[model samples]
Target: MNPKISDSIPQEDKDFDKQHIWHPYSSMSKPLPCYHVKSASGVRLYLDSGQSLIDGMSSWWCAIHGYNHQELNDALVKQVNLMSHVMFGGITHDPAIQLCRHLVELTNPKLECVFLCDSGSVSVEVALKQAIQYWDSKRQPEKKKFLSIKRGYHGDTFGAMFVSDPENSMHSIYTSYGPDNIFAEAPQIGFDDEWNEADIEDFKRKIEKHHKIIAAVILEPILQGAGGMRMYNPQYLKRVRELCDKYDVLLVLDEIATGFGRTGKLFAQEHANICPDIMCVGKAITGGYLTLAAVISTRSVANVISGGRTGCFMHGPTFMGNPAACAVSVKNLEILRTGAWKSQVDTIEKILLKKFKPLMESGHRKIRQIRVLGAVGVIEMKNPIDVALYQRRFVELGVWVRPFGKLLYIMPPYIISEDDLNHLVYSLISVATDESLA
Candidate 1:
């Protein structure tokens, strides 16, 4: 390593980044402060400032086994030496084949076909396209629009953005150009709230009224990320599955954020015990080693698309099945099969609830609600937080937690130690509870 570079990324480097790089939702006129992470291992991010922060966001909820994992690194390196990438046009490889095979077994075994993508958004685009094409194959081209819940976030692509909560999401500005997908009222029933049949009323109404035009009922399953880190009743999803089946609308489950044991189950759809016609899994699929996502579907869906009027699904990425990413993901699945995440997520949830109880019991005025499920813990504020201010505060206190909108949340890696977990939870709660910051 360059001694000068290792000492720090340099003030000029930070200055150059601020001038040139336009980060998510940041403007060039007044950009958000960006930190330089020297390296990462396990649950800590060693920064250029000679300070290490316990990562609470899991590098945006993908590093389930933490960072700089030896197994994942070796897998990626081994595949890279053999061959980094190759055109998937009329070729196949073991890594891609093995990864897809593992994904099918790990998820719903019946979801046999896998469509690899560059990111979560692309996976969603594939899912949306599949639904429309499936209907077209059946000679129902009119069934194009999707039915999605409010406060739901799918992804940032045009197709993904349209299906997300248009009015309340980060992509609202571009909603005018997006497809006019149906948006039912967001689920009013909380994750732990009493499961009233009324909670699913609006969704059911929309499905019934628009069954003819709706191609699919696409949702985030039991847990919704990004738009709002809200969890809903599993029964709501079960009922949604039933309605989709009854109305002849395909069901697409976007398990991007909640897949790979994030929700205590391997997949969030398992909570409802219902298999959708198409499913999107990403984020943690490669254990944060590389960018990869998959749109897995049933044989019926895949066959219909291939034998459709247009022919062969009509879409594919240049890096469709990159060997290195596939090898890393295959290893990631093998490690997950070891079942270590089960206990880690179990303990993390238990400890979060235990530590967060004091805040709930205190009845803090600023706190809107407190929710925990699996490895995710959220403390919703009554008002939106000063993101930049709170972010610096968190760094100063030696933790990395990125809060958005009204949600101050943590989705830490499953392998985080008890001490690191407490440190992160305590540091976050302290900032949340502190009157000076609030």
Candidate 2:
């Protein structure tokens, strides 16, 4: 057992949380019941109620190695004994250097430069700035707009929001407050569907028409999260890369959700065998241990931005390269490099396909579609679901599965055992088959 940080918060503290704390787009006035977790280990969450539930969300798809991992804990402890955080403005540390080197080696060769940020959104914001500054350096300041697909999700920050699928994105209400970036229709073909020329043509025309004003073409690549758990063909990615090169527009792939073997590759862009000018990665970077994201770019983009009108990147978070986070991230990459994560994800995909087959063949009218990729399994419903209701039901069934809009999905920790995974499947089936849930 780990040493205690402090005495545990009593029930009164939770009541106060209900009264005051805002929980991620939830209504405080009619707040949903917040489950108080006491501790977590492996793939299970131990609640204050003394009950443990299998974690199916992976803490929103970040905790790849699961909770309370000894290796990650040791890494953090060692880094804490040395130092935690230091300013990255003019100073650097071994943790930061080693982490950056690991990231560069993991990605495409041209993507050699890394800009560490505090979160996924900030990394994307940095990517946007890099693309814009790259164009500004090339003497085309008006090439400032970003073009993205209709169902893509980058992040919630203003710049990231501008490049996301505004209409379907949760930040849609703030559309009037942010820049109106262009949106091309999402590819019609599924990941497993036949390659369609029409899909490429639709996106090609949009890029060709707006190439002059578009500084970059940003996409989630392969899998789209948040907006929808949508998957598309890698061929589209290849074509998009070609179009970007043809128009001299930079390509920015936001792999915050798809990176780090989540989509059966260390980077989802690898599926297409093409490289982006800038790539944003986060989530599993630290094995869900700490907050750390990065914006990796090619040497050309870095050089152009350095010599640009701005004369610098013009952005740096105070905790840009937190040593503790970098140290944990390096350890996380080391764990992944063992090649076990690939086999684990492949096993997850196969199991999800087998377990979800009944639902796929159920012929239920309420079911819209079902899809699985890598470790992600999604059940899209025809009608919008009551998030609070479904979440409560999942918890009652001894699992944690957060349903958003019409999508009920699970991206469990890669270390999950078959028995635990089957239990998660049982909970999902219970939610889907229950007429009362509708």
Candidate 3:
């Protein structure tokens, strides 16, 4: 039998949650089955039913160091003892300062200014505001629209929602509610596929036609997450930078999913050897220990907005720069800087390539494509599989993976053992090989 709720949580609370608490992309009236996790350690999730499953999603690709990390734990504890939070409007703290400094230094040298926010979506909001304000400062308020690619996923907030690929994303219904931002075709070529100039022609034409009204060109860099686990070549980004420069438009790269070595680099823009005018990073920033995101910008963009009539950026979250989050994030950055993530991601990539090769080669009739980048491995099916059924199967098989749309993917924690990764691959293969579940 499954255990009751945690000692701290009443059984009634669990019952209430089932009836009222809506999960991501879930309907409140017809909720999907929910699993109860008691605790997590390293790369495994311990469930209330006394089952242990290797985590394949990394809690949506944030916990790079894995769960229950001693360093991250100690950092959070120490900060809580000092203070949990303080209003960032008038006050400042060393934890936030240190975290921002590390972020600026670790990113391209040109990205010097930082705005710490509560989540990835909020950081994107702040970036959008900064871009708009920068143009407003120059009296070019007409430069209000954004240009982005199809099959791109930024975030769910209003401004972020506007830039994401509407039809492919969950926010399609809200498209009518959000701004009608320009959309270009996603690169036709795959990440490993040879580049073709024709793939970017439509994007170029869109930008050239819309440059006057386009404030910024925002994208997920090389890897587009959520909308689909689509990975494209860096030359697309290279061309974006050149075009943005030519049109005097700001470039914003949303690295919320790809930052901090998730894409075989500390930042995905490094693959193109370019620096965006503004960048939004979150998810792994605090090692998934806390809700924290940052909008990093070049000093030029910062000065332009601040020097304008407003005299300051107009957005602030209540929990902006929570000391606990920053303190833990500082420690997380220290751990990431130790340089284990790079080699670890490389290993994960190799294992994924080796393990998934069979499915890619032999399962072509059922599989659409197989993609691997850094720690991310995805098997795209010709049609969407049964989500609840597949999830239950993975749980029973001692692995945890969340499938969405036609993609069954894993973005495992960096600290995952090679053996654990192999098991995850094995579980996925088992399902792909079983047509009954399809």
Candidate 4:
């Protein structure tokens, strides 16, 4: 442990933060110690108090290349010197255009146009609007409903909350609206003994039943992030793609958490050789620098939303195409293109699997399932109580691992070294073995 940052922060600074700061996802009434970060590089976060913590969750799985990489910072600095902010509604800029070109090249060739937003949740909102409007343009306005897999998480925005599984998170407010636009199933990851041929047939039946009214089928591709890091077989995704096509439903792949090499591929859909009609990506798009999100779609889908005289996608944020953010995103993509991070991701996955296999085989009554995808790994505990205890133990051991209900998972920064990864795994095992958590 180290001295609190408040001890060193100027009295004025502390007063300002205390009076005005209200952080996202935090209970302001019961505040945690605020560690004022001095600087960060690689996978380490340095605090003003002189203590460092390995960013076990990549600052909520956004820092794909760790933090404060010189290349990314230089790109942002260069762009800021030229132009800082601009309304992307009527004007265009080099950074945004270049980033679009690069991202298109990196993604599947089928995806031709990219709509910029400021966050993953907003990108998903854009996708939902586009999908619904596409149906309206095609003279099928009745196709307004969206189907998402059970336990699949999209985001916290109203539109995203409606499409996500209701039981998983704090969605009571959205449900209160009695929105008829979204539908979902309990996640079927092909891991449970209960998952049999009947379950597959039932899922297909559900899709078929809703096919006429469904504008899109939204999912997290390979792994459901907030749905407890639950992973499903690629075959399931292939089937989903096929079913969506067969039913004339657009496939919306929310790669917000799984994108930018987090899943060992540039995109998660590549594992199944499937391309979605609409793709929502964010988190690491700017390498954890500026907030940026993109909604990419095929030319066919873009054309539907592109009205020559009257039709237009009437949605965008003020910071949608901020040049500085785009510049950082371009550099981040360049680093990913070099394939330098491939072996690093592979090493992490190997370490995770090697370390977690024993826990799975240990026949621990508390563990329900273990899942791994690329550099991501998860251990689904038997219940929520155990998950909470596991998370607390992890944070106490100098690693921060948040559990989603019963699902304890890690989506660490790709830049983490072997030693740090080993320490993380040891911490997890230690916590898992504790009867307190079990």
Error of 1 at 315 (Å): 0.8
Q: Model 3, range 92-209, lDDT digits (tens) per residue? A: 9999999998998899999999999999999999999999999999899999999999998888788888898888888889988868999999986388788888889999999999
> How many clashes (backbone atoms < 3 Å, residues ≥3 apart in a chain or on different chains) does model 1 have?
0
Clashing pairs in 2: none
* Candidate 2 structure quality by residue, lDDT tens digits, 138-208: 99999999988998888888888888888877878889998888888998739988898789777788889
lDDT of 1 by residue, 29-131 (tens): 9987777788899999988767888999998889999999999999999999999999888999999999988988887877999999899999999999999
Instruction: Candidate 4: list runs displaced more than 4 Å.
Output: 1-6, 10-20, 32-34, 182-184, 190-197, 385-396, 436-438
Q: After superposition, how far is residue 169 of candidate 4 from its true place, in Å?
A: 2.1
Residues 314-412, model 4: lDDT tens digits: 787988888999999999999988998788788888999898988878758777787777888887777774443454466557676666566667778
Candidate 3 regions off by >4 Å?
1-14
* For model 1, the run of ten residues with the poorest summed lDDT: 1-10
Q: State the C-alpha lDDT per candidate.
A: 0.90, 0.90, 0.90, 0.80
